[model samples]
Target: MAAGAAPVTTESDCRCDVMAVTDRDCAGVTACPGDRGLLLVAPGGYRGRVRDPNLTRSAAGQLSPERRATDLRRLRTERFDVLIIGGGVTGAGAALDAASRGLKVALVEARDYAAGTSSRSSKLIHGGLRYLEQLEFHLVHEALTERGLLATRLAPHLVRPVPILVPLPAGESLRDLPARAFRRAYYGAGVATYDAFAGVFGGGRGMPLHRHLSREGARRIFPSLRADALAGAIRYYDGQVDDARLVVTLARTAASLGATVVTSTRAVGLIRQAREVTGVRVRDLEAAPGSPDAEFEVHARVVIGATGVWSDDMSRMLNDVGLRPGIRVRASKGVHLVVPRSAITGETGLILRTASSVLFVIPWGGHWIIGTTDTDWRLDRSHPAASARDIQYLLDQVNTVLDRPLTTADIEGVYAGLRPLLAGEADSTSKLSREHAVFEPMLGLLLVAGGKYTTYRVMASDVVDRAARRLGGVRPSRTADLPLLGADGYAAMWRDRADLARRHGVPVGVVEHLLERYGTLTRELLALIDADPLQASPLAGAPEYLAAEVTYAARAEGALHLEDVLTRRTRISFETTHRGLESAGHTAELMGAVLGWDAATREREVAHYRARVEAERESQLMPDDATADAARLGAPDVRGFAADRGVDGDSVELPTSSR
Candidate 1:
């Protein structure tokens, strides 16, 4: 593996080029000397011809309709050692871990990967500083260790340390000087402890401990704060990551390690004989919209239910034993609102204590991600639309500290997600535990429920470690030390990023963005540009992303549907001004070519995606959950792709019921 070189194609003798063909161009196909001997064809679109990873030249991209069919056929024929049920961070982590450990692995998600709570998180990969306040030393230590790994060793490209300022209230309380000193001394000790634990993974020298600022200094740093509110603040560092990209990369890494990763595949039932669980009954979601009916069972040696909120549903499939005792999965709704960066101008993020919980105004791509109301949610789990109350809660909290208040109009995007808290019989959902639980709820069914986003890897490693024992032949989990696909030499890559950007004729900012998301794999994306110079151009509607990424997502990253490409594969839904409506058609057009969709299919994808946006808007308009669910139902299936899988070929003429 030479630096700046491309991946070699599979041998022609054993490999087949998986490029699709349109009726428009048939003469473009050419057999090339590479790993997969099948002829590659030039793909049409904004980018230059997709590059052959092995050949390094712009060869036709594989993922043609015919190749997709063959790939599906091969997937159906194969048996994986471990079948992971969710495509959240935990499940994705399990897939990567299992594959790296030499186990045959397959990960199935009913929706796009990380389409649930994973993408809708606070976007920080930090050790919970609040946990330290609660005296959960062990949890803090463990999280700090993972955070260090993510920042330095594992995903330095994706995760970087962000500084946060926690402002103390203005006052004439006890000795101001001593209290500031005490707070700094106390919090500093905790950060130092975190740093010490971080050293075990790789030193956390880059992450600084807490430092106290004077009232004047605090005001200088965050001018929006009420100057009279007069106390100082403490600043500390924590790693932030694009949660969606982490999961996407994890899935890709698993695939690179030989895991069968499928999106839009629903696990309808648990395949079982007598009391023991075996495989799963899955329906292919990528089929035509109207088609439905049959479900096929995918048999596997072990099943891991990393379904999170839907864990109960997976548990019920295997009878009462499948559900663990005292396993109360409560849904706590956390909503975030994206506002323009101009709303809060500061070098660092602001964290203040609200009456209910802490408020975070974190910075994202050219915008501020202000969030999170932790309230009870007894609504539809799938599409947790942000309610008026959810939005109001955030606005009120953010408005409390800002000089210029923000209204509903300032909101660029609003999203709501359910946090699977370990349910307790408390009157309030917030009182439930964020700590996760893994249970052998039933024979052959392993369920992981109730965890936060930061600890997904630990949860995943634990679940896979357990499943390994059941499968008989097991290898120790290697994900702890394993860098994801794009992680190798990322630091060095970052150093040479400017030169690479110049060579590729892309902006330095674009190169930085690519490095942040893909790490060393930026080279892979760059190869797409290298073969055909046109690929270097940014997407027409969504300039934030290069056009080649959309292609790379489908071919290399396993995006099965349009929504997978827009929503999870890229943060187009939340990051864009129109929630991806303007870009949906273009994206669909790009992906539909690869996915084998005709013009009609392309239209359907765009129409369905637009309806989904409209429905989400309508849902947010409703007063409550019931009304929201009804209004949301008015929209088309955004996940219609998942509904199409496993339809029977034979239309069995069953005897009509004679009443």
Candidate 2:
């Protein structure tokens, strides 16, 4: 094959041609054999349809079966300037930041990218308004700056300004009126300061500042709020992003800049010598028959641990000889409820203050996402289930202002996640600070924890900066100006989306969705659907996503399992009415074919998911963390991970935490 030409349509294709694209999985897109009758995928993008020409079939970090046989392969066979564990935003950002600066980088995640807290967020890319109350001005300012960067320069397609209204009760005390005014002024000042701060950091000036609204004005903007409930309100502008897409874009950007990223691969053991850490031992969880069972070890000079909640384990494994670093992580469980948008008929979202912290009723694609109760969590860090009590707590809080209350029947989905905080014993986890802490625990081991979603880039940059000294003076962080894949030239893509939609026979809205999720890379998914237009139809039960997205996730993004596709990649688990239970089988079937799973394997996946939901339902019925943890343990592993996979279930490793 020619240098820039696409690779052959078989597994035994030329290695050099495959290397032309970064080692990311391009499965169906680049690997499938297409019908050969002059199928023009995209007029100027790709010429032929023998395969998807977007390099979607090349799986990263999966160079060859031989290269993947042992752990520490990079440490012994080759050297990487930086080795990043955890494929969440922090790790993805680290890879992008390091590789963009001419550092040889490799990032590995025990699960799929963003499988942890990254994918399970409330999906807002906003400056923390609550931080202003805590007087964390610097953190708020930094977050606002990043929000602007993502909205305009970095990922305009993914991040957009969402209008949020904070209501004030009508029958409040005279003193309460003054207090609300004071809060408005303080919040306004902070927002102005944020706007000015963005100017200094070279961020965009597109979004407006915070505005105070009268009772009538507030009612006009948000009709769902009871007319008598509000004395006045405040309207603020913030960024909202597809959290999973952001993580994938970061990983793609890193791969584009020459970093090797792999998913469905686990870091089972750390490769180390006396008093110094070197690399990792990884095993492919879905290996084919006759595949070697031993771990693959990759050597690297510096290993920065970006594994958020798993930081303690990574740190402990790195240092078996020296005094271990203090375990400073506290896991807080946050639960969210998804209801149909008809429940709240309004334009702007509501951010209601509650005794527990705050309740956000945000609009998400024809649905209202009301959530987030923060409490102590002591079990099941991987899949924090939403129990009956958690659901009731959210419903009771949200019912305070709603004209008509919501019940279980109105619920489309419920989800829970564990947030990693600096270890503390506060009475309420909601009171914990959103600030981050980075520690160099021992030689070659950097552990980072205690940051919120908005500041993941800063957290990653700081971690890499600390480990840079060990890399013999690496370059300073340049992630601020760097745009993730699909971010660059997004504005132009948005302008031409209508034409692209017409050309591909897809709806204009579908084009918009694609641009929002993948920016210019939407063409890649469109091209795949163009080959087999049936794939272009949305998934049966979950109409929010196209069937092509599942294939794209497995091929382009590193989705190796059904759970990775349904839960993280497309949010089928949290967006559907049944929490994806009704759609799980079809999803498994589609994902199974792509991943090479037989009927037995598919049945196991379905059973595991069902048990998980049941366990979560049981856990939510409990009042406290201990009982919830115990109930949640009723379900076994959903992925049925092999013995060689990272975690061993000899004993349950539930996170014990306070506040």
Candidate 3:
């Protein structure tokens, strides 16, 4: 056994090797590192089959344990058209775009898909309305266009319009009328412009137009508004999504289009051939440190780095190869708090202006998603910390207009995300440019940085286009009108949800839940429930989810770890009061059934999730950033993913983020 070789066990007569050449689970395109024959066994005993007994694949967009191993073997031998270095939305988008255009593609993430800023986004898809004030019209228009595609043409099942209210300031007396009217005019114009941009941009038709609401009228819709806090309100529409799910769908869609996607594999360094950048040197983070498969080199004609907050790290890879790097990316921190819907008696999401930035009180299922503070972050990017001060600041701002002010006790969960803003002379992170830029430090390497979540498709297209131009004979991006994994038959399925539930012998509510999460793919879950009636039972700790959903995530959604199941695959970590602790053991058992985790491994998974929750809780209690970040260090990240993995202010787990 040698380094960068696949693990093999000698048999009585022959040797088996992992290899990849087709969409099938176990086959090889090339010779094994040492073995004479390729007998690729999909990880976790796949035996050349998809876990779904009833479904078939034209290479289905399924990311499971089996595909992960098959793809890893492909990384060792296949020379790809493009290799993307991040698994966030942008990287996943690039993979989908390139692969759809019939180019060979491979993507590697040090952590799970969307394990960084992509999962921690504000979860909105709109042209940043505030950016209209900054006159970044082009950026806003571009984002609005992408928003339309995501909500309407692309991922209608995941991205949908949410009604948002812009609370207008009400004057205390006649003396303040002039200022109040002027303020109303300003916000009204902004909302109007936002709508106008959407309509003109193509995606705006999915949502209703902006409407002015009187104080009395606004209160009728949102009864929790403090009477004196606002005179009138302007209601507008913006899109929202399950950000992490979007990334996973993008990765899966890429795989369906013949891309090799693998997670927990970190891009340790660049693979250079003299003056030409060739590929990347990667380490399998999930592999045992001294194992043969721990480290490998992936050859790509061109490499696209969508590392976001970790963009500076791309520069360091250049320096490691004795080249001066030229990408400048800075990080902006945004913290969000989740509380029960009962805590905030609002039907429509609220957008309140702060001294520096706007705050959103978005409505989620049975909960209110409130956020976020925009400030510069210089600590631990893997686990950006939000202090007591950050939490207090948000409560203070939203309390000014709430009939009953929320307290720390009202908070159910807290998550802090970092935005990769383009470095500039702007005085604050909020003022920095949201526009993304692309740079090539060498002939074959491209670094893409500094874009908002809404415009990820555009950012991906630009970078991959650059790679395509260099590589030649590539088709233009086909993603603009392409529907994601479950979007195709979603509307029809939603229309028949009641029948779907009745036919599956479950409640309509259950069918609705699955439709929203998995779209037309809900059939797969229904099949699971049909096969195992017990699969229909709701998670005892979090009834919002079903046992079958966890099984599906493990079997088809590439959930290799517990955090992948609870935190990203589902929002149980933040949506549940127990922060997923009560459900951790149950989820681990469910995933273990698919990934072959033993009792000890299941216990380790539960303990890791428990420690992570406690660490985040303690970090939030701290009064300032330094103390908050230090407190987060109390728990080690799962799979040796320390906040800083062997570098000063550098993390192997690259992140992408923001508003």
Q: Roughly what TM-score does model 1 have, to 2 decimal places?
A: 0.84
The global C-alpha lDDT for each of the candidates, from Candidate 1 onward, is 0.70, 0.70, 0.82
Number of the predicted model whose lDDT against the real structure is largest: 3
Residue 114 shift from truth in candidate 3, angstroms:
0.6
Local error of candidate 1 at 659, Å?
47
Enumerate clash totals for all models, in the order shown. Answer: 15, 31, 1
Per-candidate TM-score against the hidden true structure:
0.84, 0.84, 0.90
Off by over 4 Å in 3: 1-59, 320-322, 645-659
* Cα-based lDDT at residue 333, candidate 2: 79
